[model samples]
Target: MAEISGVVERIWRYPVKSTGGERLDTVEVDGRGLAGDRLYAVRDGSGRLGSGKNTRRFRRMDGLLRLGSRLGPRLGAPQLLDPLGSPVEDADAFLRAYLEREDVALAREDAVPHFDQLPVSVLTTATLDWVRAAVPAAVVDERRFRPNILLRTPAGTPPFVEDTWFGREGRVRGGVRLAFVRSSERCAMTGLAQPGLPHAPEILRAITLAHDGRLDALATVARPGRLRVGDAMALA
Candidate 1:
């Protein structure tokens, strides 16, 4: 008893996580990810990714805490630099400093590093509500989702609905088209204990258990564009 509904709400990017977010008025669409989202990351000698699924192994790596603010979508094209604006001639040396350990160099100039999977990430209000109701303890904010796009769909729709979005594009007013991909898989990161949140996993577990063992979110464009707020999402 449901029908296709346009995006009731959407989020275009993140300014700082574990802190606050910068809601966009409109954004461009790209393949790699939102026009300019998480272009740079802070990885130390301890090469590991913080994917909202696991964290026990996170100790090996450090300093990534700063990436949330240091990265730019392009960082002036390629050559990803730190927040301080230094040329990372040796990304290893640049990142290893935080580990206070040694360099592993898991990053790539041609790929997205320190990120869980794709450059863009997404989630839904419905799905988030489900998680909150189940755990009733953790702080399940968009930071946990780390998504560039946060969708609010028609009521009663399934959670992690991105899987159904393949071959479809979320349009904005009439300027850009942000497409959707398959569902994201869940991992131990989602179960991790955010320094202040005790019941974080109980919340994530709700989604994992509800939707088989996968995490649900959305992905968008990689190129930058001029997207206006109040755009309409139309599946193509």
Candidate 2:
């Protein structure tokens, strides 16, 4: 193993894809990813999944972000909440009302994975600080990037340090092994306004101009274990 590159700063899990997620202090990890992350997603009429960008399998339904979801009973069934922070009586109806789309419904992942790319997305505080410096007026919050693991680089570390981890192996202190697959590509979702942040198109613009539209690094769990906040990450 290599020297400690950083410490885990924050952990997040999105029970429902494309919606607000819940922060965690500790979580289980497996080959799939953080337990229950993006396990469910809103499916459109044509069987397209809801997301921040339009792709062959995903539709750009930004309104889905207005809703929030957390794991309910069964550990995978997500309980959708309204913008006012109240649990919705009917998830599909609530989604229809908020999104104004008649054919959308909440659904779980089937044979296909719900993640945009790799299962685990990792971001670092150093990169966030760099974005803040690049766009001083924008609210460059970590929530905007929606990373599953937020690593806090040591003081004075340069931004995008995680970039070097791609194609390498690493392990978290708690025994979770990972392979940094590739750099996560940024999309319009980073600029979309969510609960505590405002819509700032410039945020995406700055990333595009400076980083070629990529921000975080994507990884896949190589060994199943547990991860806790404050755990150290060592590249191998």
Candidate 3:
């Protein structure tokens, strides 16, 4: 196996699925993934979870990105916050009003995983640069991809460098080991409008034309431990 190394540039956790997430300086990685990541989501009466697309388990629910979730003073207790960062008094009522559908309500993941594919999503700075190079007119932001871990590779590193980490086990300086399963497939959600980003379908179009619509790595925790923004990552 080849050796690959870099520094953890950023860590993000989405308390609720398909919504804006909170960036952390440090986090705990357990068997499932980053603590408090995608444990809850807006579910409809038909049992389909709110998502950017319609699937057997997910329903196309617009405006989910307009909301944000924050971890309480302690982890595990996640609260849904409005875009402005105010706690919503009534989650169901707020969701109903925001989504404009009475059948929509907030729900937690049980029995099944709430993640789109894998528990953890990893994106590297080089990949973002690749996207920017492909679509220079569009805003290339990490939030558009919503990765749990953002790695900053050394200068002059080639784009999509994470592809080499696929099917490999990586150890972080903080002791978290992850097995990169596969490259994550990009979806329409990447083009959806977020707080600081506009609705840019060109980004997804460019990805589809250049990279078959895949942009990041999806992995699972191989060993539970801690991770921080400045931690070093080594892949074997």
Query: Pairs clashing in candidate 2?
Result: none
lDDT by residue for model 1 (1-236), tens: 22344463666564322212346756655555554454433333454442232364333232332332333444342342454444456655755664454644433333433345555665777676777776676677655655566666777876556677665655555455555666677654455443333335565567667777665544556234555544445666
C-alpha root-mean-square deviation, candidate 1: 6.0
Compare the candidates by lDDT and give the number of the best one: 2
Ranking by lDDT: 2, 3, 1
For each candidate in the order shown, give its overall lDDT on alpha carbons: 0.51, 0.88, 0.88
lDDT string for model 3 (166-236, tens) is: 88988887889999989888899999998878899999898898878888888989999999998888888
**Which residue runs does candidate 2 get wrong by more than 4 Å?**
none
**Can you tell me which runs of candidate 1 are displaced by over 4 Å?**
1-4, 8-23, 43-67, 70-98, 102-108, 111-116, 193-199, 217-225
Off by over 4 Å in 3: 1-4
TM-score of each: 0.65, 0.96, 0.96
Across 1-236, the per-residue lDDT of candidate 2 in tens digits comes to: 48788899999999999899988899999889999999999999899998888889999886778788888535857889887778999899988878889999988888999988899998999999999999899877898999999999999988988889988877887899889988878888888988878899999999999989999889998999999999999988
TM-score of 1: 0.65
